[model samples]
Target: GAGVSQSPSNKVTEKGKDVELRCDPISGHTALYWYRQSLGQGLEFLIYFQGNSAPDKSGLPSDRFSAERTGGSVSTLTIQRTQQEDSAVYLCASSNGQLTNEKLFFGSGTQLSVL
Candidate 1:
């Protein structure tokens, strides 16, 4: 892909359902990250994966949130048993291998609204 790609772009679900948001990172990029941004809020780092080194899941808000990256490329973020507080934009980004200070290219994101 020319840039990171995110599926659905928008999702609205009832408060107890589960939703899966997909992300396709730029080719050859070695680091991929998932973030969440609520309405009028800053980006919240959910997880970071780099060539499988024990995925950094520190930022996951709760047990209901999970993510996985396959082949060091595309990734998916799944929110289970969604709640009203979970309504926000699920964003994904990728970089050309990590070294900190490297810019991350973001996707349009899947807007999930839990009503």
Candidate 2:
């Protein structure tokens, strides 16, 4: 894909269900990130992965939310026992991992609706 690609575009699930969102970063980018945007809110950083270093999970909201990147290219975000508060737009972005020239390319987020 020429840019970051996210799956499903939209997802609707019950309050207690689990959901998995996917992201495919631009080929060769070495950094991937996940963010959340709630209704009328700003983007909140969730997780970040760079090269082989341990992922920075500092921004994750709770233990129920987790993410993983495979082969440094594709990533998946899993939310367990979803709550109404979890309804939001899940966004993915990627960059070359060069601090001096870092620029993120974002995907069209997946809008999650928990009822």
Candidate 3:
């Protein structure tokens, strides 16, 4: 992909339903990250994956939020039993690699709304 692509640009769901958001990252990139941004809030790092490195799950708000990256490229974020508090823009980003100084390219994001 030329840039990151996130699915379901806008999603409206019931308060207890489950939702899956997808992300397709740029070609050949080895680092992928998932983030959430609420109204008037900053980006919250949800998870991070680097080649052959342990995934950093330090930012998941709870067990109901989970994500996975396969073959070091595509990723998915699933929210089980979603809550109204979960409504927000879920963004995905990828960098050239895990080098700390690398710049990140972000996807427009899936705007999930739980009523």
Candidate 4:
């Protein structure tokens, strides 16, 4: 894909179910990130992966939320035991690096709805 690609544009699950969202970054990009935006709210950083360095998971709201990047290319975010409060649009973005002036290419995002 020429830009970031996220799978399952929308998902609806029960409160206790699990959901997984996938993202494929642009080719040769080394920085991947996950962010969530609730209705009418700003985006919240979830996790960040840069090259081989350890993933920064500090922004995850709880243990129920987790993410992993494989081969520095594709990444997946998993939300376990979903709650209504977890419903949001999960966005993925990629950049060449963390340079202050670099711009990120974002995916359309997966909108998750927990009932």
Candidate 5:
């Protein structure tokens, strides 16, 4: 794909259910990030994966949320024990993994609704 691709543009899950969101970044991009935007709130950084180095997960809100990049190409974000407060738009972005490369390609987020 020319740009990032995300699956299940919209998802509605029960409060106790779990959900997994997927993202496929642009080819050759070595840096991938996950973010979420809740109503009336700015984008919140969730996790970051750069090449083979350890992922930066300091931004994750809780232990219930986890993400992983497979083979440095695709990524998945899993939310366990979903809560109403978890409803938001989950976005994925990718970069070239160079400090000089400031541009990022973003995918249209997956809208999550926890009932």
Candidate 6:
């Protein structure tokens, strides 16, 4: 893809079910990040992967939330045992540089609905 791509634009699941969201970054980009956005809320950083460096998982809310970037191209975010509060838009972004000043290209995101 020419830019960040996210799969399953929308997802609805039961409260106890799990969900996986996929992200594919643009070619040659090395930095990837996952974020969550609730209704009328700002984006909340979830995780970040940069080059061969260890992923920064400091933003994950709990152990149930996890993400992995494979081969520096694709990434997946998994939410285990979802709760109603977990319903939100999962966004993925990628950048060419690891520095905070770099510009990021974001995906359309997957809207998760837990009932």
Which is the leading candidate under lDDT? 5
Task: Extract clashing residue pairs from model 5.
Answer: none
lDDT of 6 by residue, 1-115 (tens): 7889999999999999989999998888899988889999999998888963446899999999988877878898999999999999999989897685358889999999999
Q: What RMSD does model 5 have?
A: 1.3
Task: Estimate, for each residue in 5-92, the C-alpha lDDT of model 2 and write its tens digit.
Answer: 9997999999999999999999999988899999999999998888534458998899999888888788899999999999999999
Local lDDT at 56 for model 6: 85
**Higher lDDT: candidate 3 or 6?**
6
Model 4 per-residue lDDT tens digits across residues 1-115: 7889999999999999999999999999888889999999999998888963545889999999988888989888999999999999999999986763258989999999999
Q: Estimate, for each residue in 45-95, the C-alpha lDDT of model 5 and write its tens digit.
A: 888889745458998899999888889899999999999999999999999
Query: TM-scores of the models, in the given order?
Result: 0.93, 0.94, 0.93, 0.94, 0.94, 0.94
By summed lDDT, the worst window of 10 consecutive residues in model 2 runs over: 94-103
The local lDDT score (0 to 100) that residue 66 gets in candidate 1 is 85
- Ten-residue region with minimum lDDT total, candidate 3: 46-55
Tell how far residue 34 is off in model 6, in angstroms: 0.5
All predictions: root-mean-square deviation over Cα? 1.2, 1.4, 1.4, 1.3, 1.3, 1.3
**Superposition TM-score, candidate 4 onto the true structure:** 0.94
In order, the Cα lDDT scores of the candidates are: 0.88, 0.90, 0.88, 0.90, 0.91, 0.89
Residue 113 of model 3, lDDT score: 92
